[model samples]
Target: MVNLFSHNISNSNAINNIYNIIYDYASLISGVLSIIGCSLNLFLLYILIRDKQFHTVSYKLIRISVISDILSSFTIGTGCLLISYEFTYDGGIILCRVVIFFTFTSNGVSILNLCLIAIDRYFAIVKPFYRRYHRRRKQIFYLSQIFVWTIS
Candidate 1:
């Protein structure tokens, strides 16, 4: 009975150790990637904002997408990093709710932006006349963005 109990305890400890290692590595990789992603997105946003030539509907959509990406990276990515470091927020339930809200909203916005891009491409390629019409209606893109935010 003593040997059995000792063996079970050792096995449980080993399993826990393995789990910790995996979680640590996963969190580290996710945090690093998120930082890289946010950096690249910010660079792209800067270029878009600096260049007047990029002030088109598509570019606007891209800018919105990048903004959402940055938000996600900052909120979710930072949370993951904190967890990996065994740090707790202790900022109460409101902070937790805010984090969750921003993370999900940003993710939703990102997805919606992609859908807008795809629709724009479809009109450009599959319906060239409609694409020309779209070019004159820049408000459409802005409206779509607003709609996305509203939904998110």
Candidate 2:
């Protein structure tokens, strides 16, 4: 019969090798995508700044989403790269927690901002009058933006 302890050790070594391969490839891919995402976000920000017409509530939400997407892309690459180094190293677990928290939190914020944009579009369409007095609801819009960032 095969020795159980030796079998377990061999299996664990195989798993560790697989993890290293996956982590290295994942980090490489994530780094490339992060660079692309950050560049796109910067371009969008430039347009948001230069264009006067795209400063409405929905567009503002989209801007926020783009910003958070940039943050998320950065954090995702960071987390992947960190994991590419064995996570058991000194202080690695805490670093991972911090990196992963920001990654997920920014992603959550981006998604929530998209949802807010959808809601704004719905109101603009279903309640056509809602578009007429955006200035009156400006404070509410800002508050909702704050709430979205906060909750996420």
Per-candidate TM equals: 0.77, 0.77
RMSD of each: 3.3, 3.2
**Candidate 1 Cα errors over 4 Å, as ranges:** 87-100, 121-136
lDDT of 2 by residue, 11-57 (tens): 99999999878878888788777777878888988898789998988
Tens digits of lDDT, candidate 1, 1-152: 99999999999999999999999999888888888888988998899999999887777888898898889877766766766876445753545576689989998998899899888888888888875666666777868888999999
Model 2: pairs clashing at backbone N, Cα or C within 3 Å: none
Q: Using alpha carbons, what is the TM-score of model 2?
A: 0.77
